[model samples]
Target: MNQQSTLSSSDMPGFQLKALLLLGLGHLVTDLSQGGLPVLLPFIRESFGLTYAAAGAVLMTSNLTSSIVQPVFGYFSDRWGSSWLMPVGILTASLGFSSLGYAPGFWALLLAVFVSGLGVASFHPEGFKAARFFTGKRRATGISIFAVGGNVGIALGPLLAVAGYGWMGLKGTLVFLVPGLLVGIMLIISLGWLSEPQRAALAGISDGSRQGPRPLGKRWLPLLLLILAVTVRSLIHMGIVAFVPFYFVDVLKAGAGTAAKMVTVFLMCGAAGTLIGAPIADRLGHKRFFVGSMVFLLPVLWAFLAAQGMAAFVLLGLAGAVLVSSFSVTIVMAQHVLPDRLGMASGLMVGFAIGTGGIAATVLGSVADVWGVLRVLQITAALPVLGLILALAIPYPYKEAGQSEA
Candidate 1:
C-alpha cells in the first residue's frame, strides 16, 4: 500500500469539495440511465404489447442486476482496490442503456437493460466508498450531496426520455451517450488522485488498523433491521416510480407527457428533501430523523392515493420528499454498524435493500394485472407503516464520546 494513500484519523482532510462534486456528477450520470427506464415503460409496453407483469419484469431485471449483485462487487472493491471501475462502469452503463433505442425485440430489450444494470451495479459501491473518503468529517452531509445527484438524475430522466422520444422516437435514448462519455473521461483523468487514498483506506480496513470500536450489540442485528427498513422504503419507491405514470394515464385520463412530468416532480422533490434533511439529521440523530421521515411518509402517501386533480401532485411530491429524506441517514447508520466493511455496508444499504424492494415491483405488477393500478397504489401507501415499525426496532448503535447517535 502506498504510504500517502492511507487514511489515518490524524490526516484526513475536513472535506474535499471538488472531488466530492465530481463523484456526485458521476453518480448523476450513472443513475440518469436508470431514471430514464421507468418513464420509457409505457412506450416499450405499447411497442411490444407487454402486459403489466411483463413490464414489471423488465424493471426487475434492471433492479436485480444493478442492485442485488452490488455486494459482490463491493466485496471485491474492499479486498482489492478498484477505482478504475468507476469510469469503466459509467461508460458501460451508458453504452448499454443507449442500446435500448435500437433493440429489435423483447429479448434484446432485456439484454440491453441487463447490460446497463450491470454498469449501474458496478459503480455504486466504489462510488460510495470514494465519496466517504472525500467527505472527511461531514459524512452524512457529503453522502447526501452524492445521493442527491442520483435523485436529480432520476427526476430529470423523464424529461430527457420524453424529449428523446419526441425528437427521434425510441432512438433518442442515444442522447445519454454524451454525458456518460464526458464524465467517464473526466473520472479517468482523475483516477490517480481519487484512487490513492481510497485504496489505502480499503487496505487499512482490511488489515484492521482503521477499524473503529464496535457498536454495543451484535452488529448484524441492527444491520438486518436497517436493511428491512430500507427494503420497505424501496418497495414503496419502486412501486410509485413504476406505476404512477400508468395510473395517471389510465385512471386520471392524463396525457403521457403529463404522467412523465409527475414522476419528475416526485423525484426532484426527493432531491430537495435530501439536501434539506441531511444536515438536520446530523443534529437531530440519524435514527430519529429516519423514523420521523417514515411517520411523515405514511399520511402523505395515503392522502396522495385519495386525492384528485392538483392535490394529488402536491401530496405525491411530499410523499417523495419524506420517503427519500432518510436515504443517506440509513447508509451512514449502516457504515457505523459495520466499520470494518465499508464497501459491503454501502452495497447492502444502497444495493440489496433497494433491489429487494424492486423485486416487489414484479409482485405489484402481477397485482395490478388482476386488481388494477389503484390497488397497487393503495398497497404502496400502506408500506411505510411497516418501514416505520422496523425503524423503531433498530437499536441506536453505541457511539464514541462526542459522536452523535447512529
Candidate 2:
C-alpha cells in the first residue's frame, strides 16, 4: 500500500473516536478556562491598579502568543502525531491560570497568560489533522461542530468564573480546573478523537508500521496568501472584541456587567455564526460565504457604533453572526487550498490569524488611545476590504467543492 493508504483505521479499534472527542474537548477547555479575564477585567484592573491600555496589552499577550505560534506547531503536528499535545497544553495552560491567580506582580501575570497561549498553540493543527482523518468528505461540517464547543466554552466561562469567583477568593477563580479535567477525561475515554473505521483500516495496512507522522509535502504559496488574508480578518475580529468592553464603559457609560455582556454578545454571535456558517456553506457553498462575509461586515460594524443600549447589542450580534461565520469559510478555504496540510491550515486559521490579530489589537488599542474607540472600530471596519480582495483571489469556485478533495 502507498504510505497514505497505510493510515487505515483498523490499526486501532477505538482510536479514531477517542482522538476526536478528546481533541474537541481540549479545544473547549481552554476556551472555558481563560474566560476569566473578559468577565473580570474591570475587577482585575481595579485590583491591580492597571490602566485600560496596560490591561489590554496583557490580554493581548495571551491571545497573540497562541495566534502567532499555532502555525509553527500546526506544521509540526502535521509531521508528528497530535496525540499528546492537547493534554500537555492543557496542563501548561492550567498551570498558567493557576499561577496567574498567585502572581505577585503584573509582568508575572502577563508572562503566565502568555505561556498559557503558547501552550494552546499546539492544538489546532493536531486536532484538525485528526478530524480530517475521520470525516474525510464532511470535514468542514465536522470541524465546525467541534470548534463551536469552544464558543460554548466562551459563553460558559464568564458565568462560571463569575460564580466561582463570587463564591471563592482569588484562588476560587482557579476553578478552571473543572473544565480542563472534563476534557482530559473525554480524551482518555474516546481512545483519542479520530475516525474509528479508517484508523483501523490504516492500522491494518501492509506497510510495516512506521513510527513518526507523515512528511509535510510541497505547498507554500497558497498557505502564504491564506495567511495574509487570515491575518487581516483576525486583527479586525480581536481588535473590535478587545475594546468593545472599554467602549461600553468609556463611551456608552455602561456598567462592568453590561460591558461584559456586550463582549459575550459579540462572541456568542460568532459562535452562532460558525454553527450557521457550516450549514450555510453546505447550501450556498464556502467561497460564496467567504466573500459575502466581508461585504456584509463592513457596513454592519460601521453602523454598530451609531446604535445605543439594546439596539447596539442587537446590531453587534448581527455583525458577529455574519462576520464570524467567515471563520468556517476561511478554514474550509485553507484546507481546500492545501488539501494535504490540514494542520497547517488549522494553524493559519486558528494560530497566526489570532496572533496577528492580538498584535493588531494592541496597536489598535493605541489607536483608540488617540482617536477614540468609535473611530478605531470605524477604521478597523475598513480593514476587511483587504480580505475581500484576497477572498476574490481564491480561484476555486464553489461548484468544484465536491470533487476538490485530495
Q: What is the C-alpha lDDT of each candidate?
A: 0.86, 0.67
Local accuracy of candidate 1 as per-residue lDDT tens digits, 1-406: 3221223444345578888888889999999878899999989999999999999999999999999999988877766667888998899899998999899999999999999999999999989888877777777898999889889988888889899999988899999999999999999999998877765555556676654434445566888999999999999999899999999988888998999988998999999998889899989989999999988888898888888878988998988899898888899898777655667788999999999999988899999999999999999999888998999999886454544444
Please give me the total number of clashing residue pairs in predicted model 1.
0
Taking the tens digit of each residue's C-alpha lDDT, what string does model 2 give over 11-31?
323224434455667777776
Residue range with the least summed lDDT across 10 consecutive positions in model 2: 3-12
lDDT for predicted candidate 1 compared with the true structure = 0.86
- State how far residue 240 of model 2 sits from its true place (Å): 2.2
State the weakest 10-residue window (summed lDDT) of model 1. 2-11
Q: Give the candidate number with the greatest TM-score.
A: 1
